[model samples]
Target: MLLKLNPEHLLLIRTHAASTYPEECCGIILGYLANESKTVVEVIPTENAWSGETLEDNKRRRYAIAPEIMLKIQKEARDRSLHIIGIYHSHPDNPAIPSESDRIQAWQEYSYIIVSVPNGKAGELKSWHLDGDRQFQEEEIEIA
Candidate 1:
């Protein structure tokens, strides 16, 4: 599927990734459907709630979005006539590839954009979607 994200949204996602270096940052992409293409219009940034017991490893490789916050975002989007089109997260010092945890947590029909942040800087970024077999398939991202 082709996921066309707005240039502004792209910038926001990158900025969020760069700022939240070391710890993974995640958020939702809100947009509307036009024929077969999903047009991204907004980005909703959320906190990484995977707090570790010790400071050394708190959310180093994991990110969890609060259900309450998600529900609230959904409701707000509904009110604005927008829908949740996808999700985005940064992989600090890692490649822009979805991990086992990402696949396990992903739902069907939603794009998952993984941003690679190496050395606290934004690196490669890509998008993916789950196929019928529930395997991740990279989606084409059009930064327009």
Candidate 2:
């Protein structure tokens, strides 16, 4: 599978990641899915809702979006005739790859976009899709 996003949408995600440097930034992706491609129609920047009590649960290494936000986005997207095709987040000072925690938290059929933020700057951007076997497979990202 692959994900298609416009330059503007990409930029928005990158900027949001950079702005939230040292912590994970997360959001929702609204788009249409056809065959093997998910074409992005909108990017919604959201707050990192995960508040872990321990250092291991810090936002710098983890992120979560509120369930209420998810419901709200779903309703808005449905009204606009779009679907929630994926979720996006930043990996501050880490590779743009899905970690074990990511895989455990992911839902099949949803694309996951990870942006690498290094030194408060957005570096590489990559997309992933969890397969039936519960493994993350790299997804092609088409920016057009």
Candidate 3:
């Protein structure tokens, strides 16, 4: 399905991704207008517990959305008459494609938006939805 993103939400994702370049950034995508059509109203960035360098492998990066933050996001979504439509994260080194680890960790109900920050710049952002067999299918995101 296609998703329409507001200007503010688009800016938030772009700024957040740019600010956290070279390290993974993460957040939640909140959706409103849920009757017959849905549109994204907000993108909330949360604290990344795993945002720093890894002792085992400096090249590899990790990030996780804490339970407390998740609860807060849920509350915010509810307050705004919205729902959790997706989860967003920046890929420091890789392209805007779902990695094996990402696929393994993604839930069936949530869309996954990957922002690729190659060369410490936000190169591209892409969205994916998991199918019945748990495989990713690309979705279009329109900024309006």
Scored by TM-score, the top model is 2
**1-144 per-residue lDDT for model 3 (tens digits):** 677787677668767887887768889988864443347877789766664455643323667788888898899778867899888888886888997777887987677888888777777888898889989998877778
Predicted structure with the largest lDDT when compared to the true one? 2
Overall lDDT per candidate, in order of appearance: 0.90, 0.96, 0.78
Q: Give the winner by lDDT: 1 or 2.
A: 2
lDDT of 2 by residue, 5-122 (tens): 9999999999999999999999999999899899999999999999888898899999999999999999999999999999999999999999999999999978999999999999
Give the range of the ten consecutive residues with the poorest summed lDDT in model 1: 51-60
Estimate TM-scores for all models. Answer: 0.93, 0.98, 0.85
Q: Over the stretch 1-144, how does candidate 1's per-residue lDDT look in tens digits?
A: 899987788789989999999889999999997776788989999999887687655676888889999999999999999999999999999999999888999998788999999999988999999999989999998888
Stretches off by above 4 angstroms in model 3 are 33-37, 51-60
Residue 67, model 2: lDDT of: 98
**Candidate 1: stretches off by over 4 Å:** 52-58
Assess candidate 3 and give its lDDT.
Answer: 0.78
In candidate 3, which residue pairs get closer than 3 Å at backbone N, Cα or C atoms, i.e. clash?
A: none
| Model 2 bad stretches (over 4 Å) | none
lDDT of 1 at 17: 94
Check candidate 1 and list the clashing pairs. none
